[model samples]
Target chain A: MALLIAVAADDSLREQNVGQSLQERVPGAATVDIHGLYRAHWRYLVRLAVLLVDDTPSAEDVVQDAFIALHRRSGSLRDPDAALAYLRASVVNLSRSVLRRRQVARKHLKVAEPQTVAPADDSVLVRDEHRATLVAVRALPRHQREVLVLRYWSGLSEREIAQTLGISNGAVKSAASRGIATLHRVLGGAPDA
Target chain B: MRDGMGPDDIERQLRDSFDARARAGVPDGAMPPPPRFATAGAAPRRHGRWLAPLAAAAVVLAVVGTVLGLQSGSGHHGQQPVAGPSGRQTSPPVLQTSATAAPVDIRMVPVDGATYGVGMPVVAYFSQRFSSAKPLVAATSVTVSGKPVHAAWYFEKSAKPGYPVEGHLRMRDYWPAHVDVHVTVAANAITPATTVNFHTGARTIAVVEDAKHQMVVTSDDKSLGVFPVSLGTDSTPTGRGTKVIMAKQPSICLSGPGFHGCGIKYAQQLTFSGEYLIAAPWNAALGLRDTSNGCTNLTSADAEYLYRHLRVGDVVKYPDTTGPMMQVAGGLGDWNVPWAVWLKGGLIPTG
Candidate 1:
């Protein structure tokens, strides 16, 4: 059953990539080997999506959609080597879409059942310490979360994060600082080193 | 003593939490199914037979001119391209490419939208080994209840091959009950920028008695209930000290040396080692008889009530038992360990 799910996900990603490759045009630009690129980067991209969405199924969908979007515009890129950058940007944008949709659904659910607690199936089994840390991370503001995730989780440089999010490098730095400071305060202060 | 955690510590904790969660959520395997889209780019090619030869001649002239220019050293723009085994010119150095590959995979512990016990901490993990921790520490941030937290980051060294180094974050104290926590790591600082949100649930604690054969429950220090229970036999004593509720089930089948296909209802597992549970036994009278192996038997009504109210990470203290203290990592029983011992078990080295 797990294997089947994985295969289905892989196929979905490839189909999106193929669909995208056919849509966008870059006149006289070199055509990238979309298959090779997909093979190499699909897992990594999905992991990125998982961090953003916090679920495997949604993360897979997010990454697949990003590849398809990249494929559509792959031909128009001024530099063919910039394909990875484009994919990363697409993934981030699509993940936002997923989160926005989830927020809407949650709002509706809240309206329908104001007093009900969240279902238990929504959480994964992990250590209490880890769970607390994640809670703190999730509580950060959207921009700050993006910057922190990109900086620490993705290991992207400040400039690269700025480019991906279409923000200034200085903004990235400040957002990150504020975000970390917020985390420290929210987590009840860091332990003595 | 103040926890003067610098950027490096925060970076490490973030990396550890993210990596651990990502590892759990995403399976390592082949990609998923392909997407469906219209074949929009399949247009007929224009016939350009005459231009083919001209294009080849232009390419040949350009290659000759480039070689001559390189020999003269005047037209060499940057690092000279070397000839490969196939006799083709290698491409020039890519200036725009980053020095270190971005961390494409990440895992955050507790996951997004998860409700956790107040003792939980925020952790993040990345797939890339960090050479410089400055940018990561500067760019990543965490907050709880609209307020920032002073979180320490610890670099977690990986034990398995192919697994990337991890980062872990923790607060000096446990989380406040019923508060939301937010984490933000800037885009490109890790992979792509992202945010995580999770909320802490109510606070709960359990007091168990092996000598009196009873238990008491409390929420936020207010007494909730007191019920009778049956503890372990003399030979197979129940584990003493504090243990965290690791999981719960509506019903569980009891099997092992002292039992005969007996079923337990409303089972709440107290130990991480899976040896002990606080549950209602098949026979209600067992609640007053100390005949079980290692489990604590309770009445059906009380078991169901406690099971419904208890949350993972709630403390279950065996205050009156002579058994050994729960081991750290033996389950979620970190509370059983001494303060100094607990600090030593941290992923980060402390002063």
Candidate 2:
């Protein structure tokens, strides 16, 4: 019991020091050190947004908006400890908006015929195959795609995924299974284990 | 089954096919996750009838492409997202000219500004009209030594049609120290073609210790005053290091993500560092929050001063504050108090 307490105390001290050190480097940054905070997590945020938006540029925009929001609300972040949580929430919210925008655009924006097309050849065949897979993935319901991206690409633990997305563990698993099943149907039976 | 494939076999094939498609730049719609799949709901796409066969074909072709190992040497060339003239905000990559046109009288107007956070606008005003409706400029396909760059255009609707058109460029994050932007506008068009030389100056000339931590300025030089400002919490540290000043905007809309701001055409920003060109709000409730995406949260006035004076290539650095030993090295890293002292004293010691 003593050892456990000692270890816990040490970890707590380390964390406190990290916070303090950050605060010292960027005084008053305990809560509002958006720069340092972004350095650590922006890549992950961008990566996450990329999956959500499925477009690098749009994902970047989404993440940028999230950071801007953090800056705007820096004062209101009551617990310095929960800054990451706030950021995650903000990013998810922003991504949702992007999705909404895309849906809206799709509904109204009547695009013309594709101006460019791949030339016919073996490469074209491969391109078509890739295009097919993309279409299939896009076909999956938004929830399924989200579940798959978080679980597989983002490599989040089920629990973490649950917390970030605000869902039960059971829901995450079910979503994953269903998504996988649909993907399976699309790919013409599993090729490997 | 068409080929007597089992469910497990099908699932694996699908996953592989999907992943393969992603690698091909086919826009597999896959993103890195910590997914909000639940709250956001499952993949909301309504697959049309034609999707299945196309996907199957895609899988077959991808497998063949893999085996042939003929990596298409050609990179993915995505079509510009076409937006209409009036309602569309996204700017297609500006057209570039390789051939130099007859030397038309070109006026150089350098406007500098900064942002409070990422994706904020950086606008610039031209005193006179652009000479070209389609002035010839060097290619827009330029990248700084370190980071890739992106540009967005916002026309000054209020400006006279023939006069100088106000232009705004929102630079990305973590840019190299030196970035040169080339833009050319037709003599008659409202938008003007302008060339800018952006430099991310060296970091830290002074240290202002405040309630949170230290703020470092790059040089005693008055031409450009680049300060090192901390962003949000360390766990979510905003992008740091040096970037070059690009365009300048008088005002911008901060309607997206973590923060919001407007009417900020202060502080000339680095070309491509972390995507914060906006200024952070001075709300004490935010804990003197260094909560920007690597943008220095300047008082609007200070931002204005920097905006007017600072040129590009002014380096911005945030020395690691674990200790006080500070040193001015090219790369972004930690600095101690001694280093801070040395910097403050104007001693340029090699890191």
Most accurate candidate by DockQ: 1
Best model number under TM-score: 1
lDDT, model 1, position B215:
84
Alpha carbon lDDT at A19, candidate 2: 17
Give candidate 1 misplaced runs (Cα > 4 Å).
A1-193, B1-104, B108-111, B121-140, B152-170, B185-195, B258-263, B275-278, B283-290, B337-351
Q: Model 1 chain B, TM? A: 0.57
lDDT of 1 by residue, A1-193 (tens): 1110101111121221121211222223366656445545666677777677676556666766766677777668655457877888878887788778677767788775532322222236333444566678878887888888888778999999999999999999999999888876766564532
What lDDT does each candidate get?
A: 0.53, 0.37
Model 2: DockQ score: 0.04
Residue-level lDDT tens digits of model 2 in B8-74? 5444434444343222222211111111221132331221110111010000000000101111211
What digit string (tens of lDDT, one per residue) describes model 1 on residues B1-351? 655556555655666566545544543322222221111232111111101111100000000112222224322344222211122122332212133433333322223455656654343333234444545555567788999986554444331112233344445655678888777766543345556677777777678877777788778878988888787766656778877665455655443231323356676666533344555545454536566656777777777788778755566789877655665434444455445544443433433
Give the DockQ-based CAPRI class for model 1.
Answer: incorrect
DockQ of 1: 0.07
